[model samples]
Target: MSLEVLLDTNTCIFILNHRPPQVAERFAEHPIGSIGVSSITAAELSFGMHKSGSEKNLERLKHFLTPLAVLPFDDEAARVYGRVRAELQARGTPIGPLDTLIGAHALALGATLVTNNTREFKRISGLALEDWL
Candidate 1:
């Protein structure tokens, strides 16, 4: 299925934790296969699961990921990453490494990045962003 929105790590966490009701509400407004997350985001969630040392949370994450697409970080995304990273670094407004990857991934796929961290992702030109929180 083609992904229309690529959820960033923080957005996914918000959905998983069910903190702000609007995130889930907005997420529910989308068709199931139309939304997804980058593999980088999945890795970040998995890292949190391991760090928490909770099998229940790991299982919860697994269940939460069932209906969502997990797009890989392919060569095209890597190419975007190289260009975006260099541009941000040159401008002296570089974001975190993983955030760079996430933004580049969404740009490579031509998908809107659903993230609450707009201040950081906004540095990369041509990257579409939506804040769900």
Candidate 2:
């Protein structure tokens, strides 16, 4: 599947919880295989699962991930990360480390990042964004 949209952690959580409904509605508007999450996003979700220690939530996460591709943070993404981090640091508007990685992943893959945290993500120049919420 050629992923066109990379779901951020918060967007995934909103979908999982079915809040506001529009996020899931917009998600459904897209074709399958065109949407996915970065491995960094999966890690963030995993952290939440571990912290909550809820088997039900874990199972839900597993089920949520079953159909979507979890794109890995590869060498290309690392290269993008370096550039992104440097640019953000230079601008004196550095976001969180994980967010930088996530943005870099989306930038590397040329996928539009679907996120609720646009204020933070918008700091990365040339990174496409869509706030489903």
Candidate 3:
């Protein structure tokens, strides 16, 4: 059975920059299904790309994500963010606010979250965390 890995923001960047073999290997491990990317990840990438002053790289990033399914910051996701945050706080998981939001989106979509930063996100009980670190 293949897993629908929701590419985390950091792993997404690493995969896009061609800097990590682990991310690619993970894809190969579960390629039969599809990949999911969050818009929050795109915002993070755009912010970083803008800081680097590389329009070409930004274009490349856009093209890279064009084929993946996008998990938008929709109302349902926002609602899940609140619930996920409450659950995490109650469970003593101190992930950063942004990561919480991203993980919540993955949870709402029922997709396994693929990331390098697992410690923070693993705190949320239902977040299927897969590390590519």
Candidate 4:
């Protein structure tokens, strides 16, 4: 499965908020259909929505996710995640589980990961990354 990009939760949040023109502009450069997100990101956004307890934010998140492809943590992604997690653990540099999952999803789909947290995502071997923020 070919994908142009996989947006991280932070990038999606930035797009939803429309703050920091630079970040927003970077997101805008890609066509909506070409942009993708991991199911993990969807869950993360949903969690934020639930925590906020704001119907308005929930609506905004729904609208934002409508056009983008939400990739699942399928078998391939799971395998990638296991390898990545093991490698990081072996190196004594472990990132968040969600971040590792997101990286695995991107790797499985051959999509460049757009994130602001390059410092963490960079630890995943063979995962292409870009800092849109």
The best-first sequence of candidates by lDDT reads 2, 1, 4, 3
Candidate RMSDs in Å, in order, are 0.8, 0.8, 2.4, 1.3
lDDT string, candidate 2, 102-125, tens digits: 999999999999999999999999
Q: Each model's TM-score, in the order given?
A: 0.97, 0.98, 0.87, 0.95
Candidate 2 Cα lDDT to native: 0.96
Report the lDDT tens digits of candidate 3 across residue range 4-94: 7788888987787677777776665655447778888878877888998988988988887777776688888899999988887887766
Instruction: Assess candidate 3 and give its lDDT.
Output: 0.81
The CA lDDT at 48 in model 4 is 100
Higher-ranked by lDDT: 2 or 4: 2
- Model 2 TM-score (2 dp): 0.98
**Candidate 3 error regions (>4 Å):** 1-3, 28-33
- Please give the distance, in angstroms, between residue 87's alpha carbon in candidate 4 and its true position after superposition: 0.5
Q: Per-residue lDDT for 65-91 in model 1, tens only?
A: 999999999999999999999999999
Give all candidates' CA lDDT scores: 0.95, 0.96, 0.81, 0.90
Q: Candidate 4: where are CA atoms >4 Å away?
A: none
Candidate 2: which pairs clash? Answer: none
Instruction: Name the lDDT value of residue 70 in candidate 1.
Output: 91
